[model samples]
Target: MPNDTILVVDDSPTEQRVVVSALQAKGYRVITAADGDEAIEKAGREQPRLIVLDVVMPKKNGYQVCRQLKSAPETQHIKVLMLTTKNQDADKFWGMKQGADAYLTKPFASDELITNVTRLY
Candidate 1:
């Protein structure tokens, strides 16, 4: 397996598992967070090269987490891909406005996610 660690953040257990499975299949070392709070905490502690962040979650949302992460020197260099069910253009704009490096809508194909992640990583 590759040594590149990726942090997967999502509130849904099923969704999280799917993301983890896809990333792991491609040989990435994966860590998971169930909510935004844990996402931020683990991102700082693990210092993963990339974070797959969900827009909707308990505690802080993806935008908030992304904003904070991008603003802080410790985590600002880390890249973030916002993965969510919100497919609206405005949502994508908002995510980008909050410092997300990329955005992907849910029901995403494994290859699609991998493509975006690898590009950002």
Candidate 2:
């Protein structure tokens, strides 16, 4: 998808930079949010094509944000990729239940992220 934007939602500055740089390098516009609340606001205001979300955050967590977004008619069309350190099978299942299109564990390669995102779009 040409001109598609991606929202990288993570509290860790390093993780945010990693995802932003990786996606930008692949010619996608990248937006950053420090936590789930910000992510929700940006998801509405920026209307990015995809959201790369982290599970652990100070307020509203990724799962809660994803659920909120999925439930909202205005944001439901946006795809969500859950990227987090929580790699348990149950976590993946819950993420899916919360409406994540894809689930990825931490330490995942940049290429893998790009590949999964590209495949999703």
Candidate 3:
């Protein structure tokens, strides 16, 4: 089995498109959520193997979503990668605190993204 399903949670349509396209091209089954709450719901339903999440979004934010997923037994095993423009150390620190497996700053290289995701798998 390919086992490449990835849930991408980001509010920006442009960012979503870029990330989703890159992952899909790498043979990932991409599912998108526009915000944190939707991410939670979809995560429950889709149970994707990985999640690429954005930090800033309406209604809950990626950190909160990652925390919920990591805290819950039903979702804790799923890997989470934080992909956001917030490059501050505090931001990355907080993302990790919320159980993100990896953090990638925005404007990231496509190859790097692929490498990181592949490594997680």
Best by lDDT: 1
Clash counts for the predictions, in order: 0, 0, 0
How many backbone clashes are present in model 1? 0
What candidate 3 gets wrong by more than 4 Å, as runs, is 1-3
lDDT of each: 0.93, 0.92, 0.92
Ranking by TM-score: 1, 2, 3
- Full-model lDDT, candidate 2: 0.92
Give the CA lDDT, 0 to 100, for residue 89 in model 1.
99
Which regions of candidate 2 are displaced past 4 Å?
1-3
The 10 consecutive residues of candidate 3 with the worst lDDT sum are 1-10
Q: State the TM-score for model 1.
A: 0.96
Worst 10 residues of 2 by lDDT: 1-10
Local lDDT at 32 for model 1: 95
* Model 1 worst lDDT run, 10 consecutive residues: 1-10
Q: Report the lDDT tens digits of candidate 2 across residue range 27-96.
A: 8888899998999999998888999999999999999999999999889999999999999999999999
Tens digit of per-residue lDDT, candidate 3, span 1-121: 1245899999999999999999989888898999999999988888888999999999999999999999998889899999999999999999999999999999999999999899886
